[model samples]
Each structure stands twice: as C-alpha cells, then as structure tokens.
Target: EPEVTQTPSHQVTQMGQEVILRCVPISNHLYFYWYRQILGQKVEFLVSFYNNEISEKSEIFDDQFSVERPDGSNFTLKIRSTKLEDSAMYFCASRTGLNTEAFFGQGTRLTVV
Candidate 1:
C-alpha cells in the first residue's frame, strides 16, 4: 500500500532557527493536513490544504508557519521562526474524504533548544 513518508525521524534545532518538516502523502489522496502533539498534550490541528491552497488552518498555524506542495509527491511545512514551544511531534496526514480516515506519517519529532 502507498503510504505517507516523513523525513528525519527526529530533528534538533536552535530556538530561533528555521526548520522544514517534510512528507510525501499517499497517492490518489486529495486533502493534506498538519497536526502536532506536545509531549503529553492532545493532538492539535495546524492546517489543511486542498487543491494547492489552504482549506483550513487552526490558530496554532500563526505567521511563522507555511505549507507547500513543491512537486507531484512532496509536501512540506516550514517554520520561519522556531520557538521552544514548537518542540513537538509534527504529523503529516492525508485523506480522500472531507471527513474521514487520515493516514499519518509516523511523525517528525522536532526539538527546539
């Protein structure tokens, strides 16, 4: 089965640097989303994109964040300015339905110091 793939299983960055988390969503899927979970906190939605534009975004997706599909298979989330609070497991997901099962990439653990 085709699956979403995220790189750098873990990332360590300085508090003020930029970081780009990457993913390759499942083929034939239409919607893409980004969600994160603090060490022990609930999973929070960051943003969702469809047809190359943002479909929805949560408050957590502030000015510092952006998403893009640079190629037929690659999707990425870039944090312009990282913060200590940004340390979390960032998950990339994709689903075909507007509201349905989202296949999650294992996750890219980002740690800001």
Candidate 2:
C-alpha cells in the first residue's frame, strides 16, 4: 500500500518566521495537493500541482506561499513570512488520477506565537 509521508509532525515558530513543510507521495501518483485545517475550522484546499507547474490554487496561496519539488520524490511548501492566521495542520495529498481516491499524509501541525 502506498501512502504520503510528512516530516516534522509538529512545528513551533515565531509569528514573523518562515517555515517549510515537506511531503513525499506514492511513487506512481501524478496529482499532488496541499490542504490545511486551522484549529476549529474546516479543511481548506490551498493548492494543486501537476506536471511541475501549479494546476490550481486558492486565494489562501498568495505571495507569501510557494510550492516546489526540489527532487522528483519530495514536494515542499514554503511560507515566506508566517502570521498567527497561518497556524494550521497542513496536509499533503496525492492520487493516481482525477477519479482515484486521494491519499493524505499525517498532517504537520504548525503553531505560531
């Protein structure tokens, strides 16, 4: 069985600092996405990437945020400057196709002080 894996299960940072969250998806999956859930809030889609380019993105993925696959196996999300509102559980997901079931990584819980 294939699954997504995330590093640093928990992170604590200052309000103005930067953070990079990492994920590794199943080897054969093509579609990758980043989603987040703020404490007490609903899960929200942040962005989707395919073919090495951004396929879709929510307003939440503004100038402060970026995603990249530095290596073929690792996907990363970088936040240039964190804010209190940026604190959330960030999840990485991937699927083989549009109709396939997406697999999500154990979310990385980020806390900003």
lDDT of the candidates, in the order given: 0.95, 0.96
Model 1, residue 9: C-alpha shift (Å): 0.6
Per-residue CA lDDT of model 2 for 8-113, tens digit only, reads 8999999989999999999999999999999889999999999999999999999999999879999999999999999999999999999999999999999999
Off by over 4 Å in 2: none
- lDDT minimum window of 10 residues, candidate 2: 1-10
Instruction: For model 2, state the Cα shift of residue 8 in Å.
Output: 0.9
Highest TM-score against the true fold, candidate:
2
> Candidate 2 overall Cα lDDT vs. reference?
0.96
- Name the TM-score of candidate 2: 0.98
Question: Can you list the residue pairs that collide in candidate 2?
Answer: none
